[model samples]
Target: MPPSLPPRRKSNTGVIVTVTLVAVLAVVGALTTVLVVMDDKKSNSVADSGYNYESQAPTPTRTYDPGPSSEAITPTQPPSAASSTPRATTRTTTTSTPSGPRPVLKTKDNPLFLGENGTNVVTCNLPKWQSTPTAAQAFFTAALPCLEAAWQPVMQRANLPYQRPKLVFPSGKRWSSGCGDVTEGEAAAFYCPPDGAIYMPFEGLNVQANKNMIGSYLSVFAHEFGHHIQALSGAMKAAYQQAYEVGPDTAAGLEISRREELQAQCFSGMWFAAAWNGKGSITDTVVRDMLEDGYQRGDDNNPSAPRDHGKRQNYGAWQKQGYEKNRTYQCNTYLAPASSVS
Candidate 1:
């Protein structure tokens, strides 16, 4: 009577049910995988918004070892026996020769060092000649203090302290500076932050003067001092940092250097403004002459030569901007438009 009873029940129902369950599971896994891929793509699309993937490579860090300390420098003899006398008196003598205009002698008060006034007056005595090493040192000393004075208020306004830098006057032959050894021919001017000092070889000033280029001498000091301003204002560190990130030869790197240099020229102008206002002695002719000389030395158009500094036109424009505006903000070549720098 129901031979069917045995087999009908156990028929293939169980096998079919097992197979259907397995197939449903497989389909669900495929859908899960597709959903996961879609979510990943959506996340990446959001992350890449407004970013140039190709050009946004990570910047490399720059490693630098601090340079050596400044060598011990001995003070040289003064132009006359003035070194021996205490409370020294400086006289300004004007001599009119067959030449167009003679150099004007200006006396500078003794420098105040380490909160002590005139401690090193004997060593700070300037030579008789305006272009002499003594004179250059004296000029630098005077200008250095003035620069500090000018920047002090500005820095203080920004809640920054004034850090004074040491000035080193080296002779022509061979001298040791914070940066390293410098020879007579290589004797331009430079600031070494590692040593916190500025190095100026008397021979460099003399050479420029002999070439009828005394203006270049002033510009050199201005440039070196400009470096000092950078050190104090954190501008120098920022520039180096930028250069390290962008590479020294890139457009950004060049812009950093140009900004520093142009600011120095502006500082030079500030000095002139102070001199003009206080003494009423710095004539427009003198400023023009100095500016022209600075331009000549700064010519960067010579592609064969090193274009790290700037061109003559660039120097002139920067100087003029500083002289006219007398404001630090205005002299900011880095932030200014290209047309302004040009």
Candidate 2:
């Protein structure tokens, strides 16, 4: 009562202050709404699935060709060649011979070597698969030489060194590799970097083709060799290492896997080009069949599939890009825009 002077008169200034506060809050709310909408739009624009088109392509006609028979069959007994011949203990590197398609063994005594802890090489004894085992080894052996001839010069031109990997045709329930033990069902063609070799059980190829025998078998070897080319190129290590460093969910991981797979496809295309150039037997029909077979094997959606190579459309487009252009640069799937190919 002593200090309560005249009640202070509320002025228009008070109302102005209240109005200004309300206006400021409204402006802040509006700005927040705009920001949230923009963020949503940006997120929606980045695609997670990328491009997939295997469903739209037409089915390809299947074909087969059994090559001429050879007498140099796989040995049924454990390899005696290495046992009888004195061998060098230290690892030896050898250059592929320049003239023809023949298996280039480090030492003539052992065209094939067992992994460090592996048992000696024994001839495949699986019933009904006897003759094919030798043929498969011979075919792969020949193919490796061809691949070396084709890729070495290309690699040298790119300022990279070429390291030839060994080819192992194991004919049993399991085979040991520098990487680890490869079981029967797990035995489609694969390149084990640790051992620097390509491995395949003859039966896996037979099963993949439903015993069709030729087209698919040749294509699988080519594809596996394609991976070997990648290993030699230093591209595979770079890609996989980058993916490992970055989490797989990140952009880098996806790009790395895409690049590795696509480059292998391109290498396979180069092989086709070489075949066309050398033998002159590679017809348009043959090319089409190869593409179709590759597409089927690479289909990613199939649950029981052995490899996550790619879908049919993806494989076909990449193969077409490599063959039609016939240039490694053209098959640069990692750098190319998604809209540029299927």
Tell me the number of clashing residue pairs for each predicted model: 1, 1
TM-score per candidate, chains pooled: 0.57, 0.56
Window of ten residues with lowest summed lDDT in model 1: 21-30
The per-model lDDT (C-alpha) reads: 0.38, 0.38
Clashing pairs in 2: 54-313
Model 1: lDDT of residue 87: 29
Off by over 4 Å in 1: 1-129, 207-216, 299-301, 339-342
RMSD of each: 34.4, 29.2
Q: Alpha-carbon error at 291 in model 1, in Å?
A: 1.7
List candidate 2 stretches off by more than 4 Å. 1-131, 207-213, 248-255, 280-286, 303-308, 338-342
Q: Single out the weakest 10-residue window by summed lDDT for candidate 2.
A: 21-30
lDDT of 1 by residue, 183-218 (tens): 433324456656666666665344433343433445
Question: How high a TM-score does candidate 2 get?
Answer: 0.56
lDDT of model 1, residue 235: 57
